[model samples]
Target: MRKILLALLVSTIGFSQNKPFAKGADVGWLPQMEATGYKFYDTDGKEKDCLQLLKDRGMNSIRLRVWVNPNNDKASGHCSKEETIIMALRAQKMGFRIMIDFHYSDSWADPAKQFKPKAWSNHSFPELLNDVYNHTFDVINALKVAGVTPEWVQIGNEIPGGMLWPDGSTNHWDQLGQLLNKGYDAVKAVDKNIKVIVHVDEGNNNAKFRTFFDNATRQKVRYDVIGLSYYPFWIKKDYTEVIADLEFNLNDMVKRYGKEVMIVEIGGEDDKVENTYQLLATAIKAVKNVPNNKGLGVFYWEPQGARSWSHYNLSAWQADGKPSPALDAFKE
Candidate 1:
């Protein structure tokens, strides 16, 4: 019995030492895509569940985005709080680890625009702080009630300049820091084990990360992970050109901040399957190479969102309702 117990302990330790690197997709558009009759088929041309298709392609995690109150438009809206909960529950049921991305807006929120949700537009700075805390807590608490606890929660999405418009922008680091702390606190209030992430775009731009995180450090922001977005298609540069920079930034972020790093959002052009495949393979290798195992994961943004439905060129899904070969990189 003692030898058996010792062997079991050794196996458990080995499992922990080889924690599976997160290979995931942000399928926020999935619910809407299905509602609008967007079907997903595997390479064999059989209709299949989108999440299962992703899993078959070596994905083990799903990321969902939450908007405060969004319209029901098929393309650009309808990630409302309720929809998010439903989606998270579905993904959780499939054994996929979850990551919740809070956009904190009525519609889209990114580096270019982090508009205050229309409902909170008139709020004072203090009220805005309350809004952030209450909204984050409410959604996260609801997820908890529904028996789906996320493994990670992002306070904001791709917030390079910052979020919540003029108030939470980098121009007002103090206020931004306070707002971020509120979000961090809210997530902890619900589940202290849930890792909180602060996300920004341009993962390859070391200077951007340095400047943003330097300010975050000075302002004493609270977070457990650094999330980034890397899309060579948008920058109109080949992945070959930016991949080295991304690797450098990934390592530098861990060494500089002493925090885990994740490529929270990354996508290549759908039409360029071979190139995208190589890009993904190289990117995954770079992330796994981060020393001390601080590279937590990589998530492709909207990979299942076929261009025919979402009209997004960077998806990993082909127009024929099948996954592009590019996704096979995750298998490695």
Candidate 2:
């Protein structure tokens, strides 16, 4: 009883800040973006005004993707670590909590392709491991220097199988286990309080999730959050199918794995964009139990499309030349 009383006292003093999210509650939503669209640069570029735009829309957080080396690309612009730190600082000034996504690659690293950056391309296995550790430490420290502390940090991007491929690939859990530890330790080494997440793409595929998280746990690497990406188009036959699978997995992950579940990235494409709003609404509704009880909130993968609003991607909010059903889904 004394221990319980002391614990309550400690929490009362430490958690004096506002937390819309209940300790195990789910009523909170983390409205955010990949934030690559803001084009956070100072080369006399047209101000994108993304921070102000999000503020007006009631978003509480921003997720920024950090690349080892950035080059102009169709999918991701490859925002450099420095550029990302500056952008995160700007968002912090705007009062938005940050979720720093480390791609650990020079370009986009998803479930399909987890490419090793050119720098780590020729390094030996041991050398590559150290490289990842150093890179992780450096990025976190850089964020501290910029006065932008991240609330959540993803060690890798949508790591469906494994990252750094072949060597750090999911196909090989033994080596993958070591790599996971290296990244997790590096983050904890700097600040034990910061949340570390290992993200995977197959949120609906309970089997895949079980296999992935099960393997990671067996490997002995502890993580605070289980980040899952559930895009209707990418994961299943359609949005409905994905949502059904999501509901199943949400309960399964939390129950079976005993770790908090976070839907880090989720959205539909043009083919499914016709009823995208309704589809997303239904999905969000299906997971309403998360905010008040479980930690389940979905983020619209990348709301801002490429350079100039392009029609190819129904993923962007401006694809329709204005807010479309896809963009409207978030407001619900």
Candidate 3:
């Protein structure tokens, strides 16, 4: 009876994972832009809700990032728990699946910087672990109360070097693994159906992915998905090379880890709109080509705002407030 019950539980957990081809976008800045009176328009120059425009373009999921005590840095306060919930509620109502990215910091949490939240700076290792658990649980609980259940949750963002600064850096894989497990456990505690993703940048770099996942596996870190950030321009690799490398990595990751993979974030230059379209289309194709349907999908990062609001030159929007043809790649 015990063996049967254990197998049933394991099967139930695996069955809860998302099976859809997650054509998504990381629109963490959307709510902040809307609050400042910015409106999105379609190619026809007709004003429309940003989420609706993406939905019309075939995007099925929205990824939002949440900061812990963003008030510690006023400029970085836009993605606070409350603001994320507001944006998430909008996406949920529009029938778009949601993915919550926890930055574990007051500001940006990327390869270059993953500063500890000011409130957690002085915490010991155990205290920091508890803080991570409590923050994740609180935010997820609040979102649930708001009637929004995120389909996927990223424990951290672009964490190629690991997160939470020196203590949880890649050199300290045990600590990093522990912190990540705290987050994974928190999400499962809230809802077992919500998949947890461990994200890293450089989707085409198989070496990096292997190293990170190897350490994670050694430490028994639990995760449901392998999320990657792919930017061809940053790597200075042309479209063909980028897609080939991405496909190779995606296949290897699935086979090695037995986990689903996704291009959690991707972008290209607006000046080269056609190239950007080709880039996105090629990436989606590469992901879909992963055998056994282990390739989940791709997500474009911050495609809505262009100039002043985001200053992202690679934005998938034209100057006239219309979505650039580059976004048409999602139609695939």
Best by lDDT: 1
The TM-score of candidate 1 is: 0.96
Which runs of model 3 end up more than 4 angstroms from their true locations?
1-18, 72-75
Clash list (residue pairs), candidate 2:
25-291, 25-292, 26-290, 26-291, 26-292, 27-291, 27-292, 161-170, 162-170
Per-prediction TM-score to the true structure, in the order listed:
0.96, 0.82, 0.92
RMSD values, in order shown: 2.3, 6.0, 4.4
Residues 1-332, model 3: lDDT tens digits = 99999999998888775366989888877767777788788877789988888988899999988988776332356798998898899898888899999999988899999999999999999999999999999999899999998989999999989899899999899999999999999999999999899999999999999999999999999999999999988878877776777889999999999998999889999889989999999999989988878888889988886665777787888877778889989985
Clashing residue pairs, backbone N/CA/C < 3 A, model 3: none
What is candidate 1's lDDT per residue for 11-41, written digit by digit as tens? Answer: 8998787667899999999998898888999
Any runs in candidate 1 off by more than 4 Å, and if so which? Answer: 1-18
What are the Cα lDDT values of the candidates? 0.93, 0.68, 0.89
The superposed Cα distance between candidate 3 and the true structure at residue 298, in angstroms, equals 0.9
In candidate 1, the residue pairs with backbone N, CA or C atoms under 3 Å apart (3 or more residues apart, or in different chains) clash, namely none
